[model samples]
Target: MTETARDIVMGRIRAALAAAPPERVEVPRDYDRQPLQGPADVARFAETVADYQARVLRIGADEIAGTIAALLPVGATVAVPGDIPPDWVAGLATVPDDPPLSNAALDATTAVVTGCAVGIAATGTIVLDGGAAQGRRALTLIPDHHICVVFAGQIVDTVPQGFAALNPLRPLTFVSGPSATSDIELERVEGVHGPRTLDVLIVEP
Candidate 1:
């Protein structure tokens, strides 16, 4: 049988790999994991999120529906995840995510309301693990606005602490602020990749 060019190249590559060392690399994890001094603080989380240009609203459980309704514009259409609490969208026009809306449909929607898996206080990051109230990744990415409801109990003091509370295998989306990027000339642009506005409602007990 004649050896083709593709076969010749692959054979050489396989031979090279076979001759390479079988040793595994050990990574160092001595870096600081939880650098924060005190317990997980909601105030610190709110301040850090605001520093990232995302709006924060601290409210009690009773005010959740009303507060969310107030933030959205009149006649706006919102995308609600399948597992999201009904009370959160009591009076709003919400499209369910059970059927998994198309990207174009999601883009046309005014905003998305979701519940976060865990929140990192130190880095001001909200993680969505595609669990429960948090829908698929595209649901959050395609929308122009995102209104996430985070519970005070879900806040962790540091990144390491946050990781310990979640499943490593799940799809995680860490959002620090509104999607933005600066060009070579330093011109800032928002909504280039994800939502331009991120409004977080930190519901306290």
Candidate 2:
């Protein structure tokens, strides 16, 4: 039988390992398991999210509904996940995902309102696990604009901390900023894979 290049390389690797058995070294993996305490973490998260060019509105819990109404254009049809707070969408034209809107219907809406599962301060990322407030993945992806409500209590300081708080088995969507990418000439283009505009409402802890 003829030996190939891969075989030759493997044989050499085996010979080297046999000649000098490698030592078993224990890798220290003290992952980010520290408890989350205080509101500073939330402030950091808001600052980082703003650097991505997304609008970050830090408001009082009572101001959420009115703030959202003021930010959106009048007469715009807003899409909402089934669990969105009724008071938040009060007096606004809203379509819920009770029967699950078709892709065309989602595309036609002015914006989608959702609440994220987690917010990462380190990367300015928002994670969705299709929670009742988040709806299915399609609801946010098909819409042109996303108005995500993230509570200060949901913000974590690091990715590891964020993962620690999430279920590993759930379907998760990580959004760093409004869907955008540059062309070959480096011209910025938005709404490539998801909403072109992301408006984050960061309520006080």
Best by TM-score: 2
- Displacement of residue 192 (Cα, Å) in model 2 is 0.6
Off by over 4 Å in 2: 1-28
Candidate 2 local Cα displacement, residue 84, angstroms? 1.1
User: What is the per-residue lDDT of model 2 for residues 32-56, given as tens digits with 9 covering 90 to 100?
Assistant: 7786775537777888889988999
- Per-model TM-score, in order, reads 0.84, 0.86
> Evaluated with lDDT, which candidate comes out highest?
1
Residue pairs whose backbone atoms clash in candidate 2: none
Local distance difference test, candidate 2: 0.90
In order, candidate lDDTs are: 0.92, 0.90
Candidate 1 residue lDDT tens string, 19-134? 99578989999755654455579999999999999999999999999999999899999998988999999989999988999888999999999999999888999999999899
Q: Report the Cα lDDT for residue 49, model 2.
A: 89
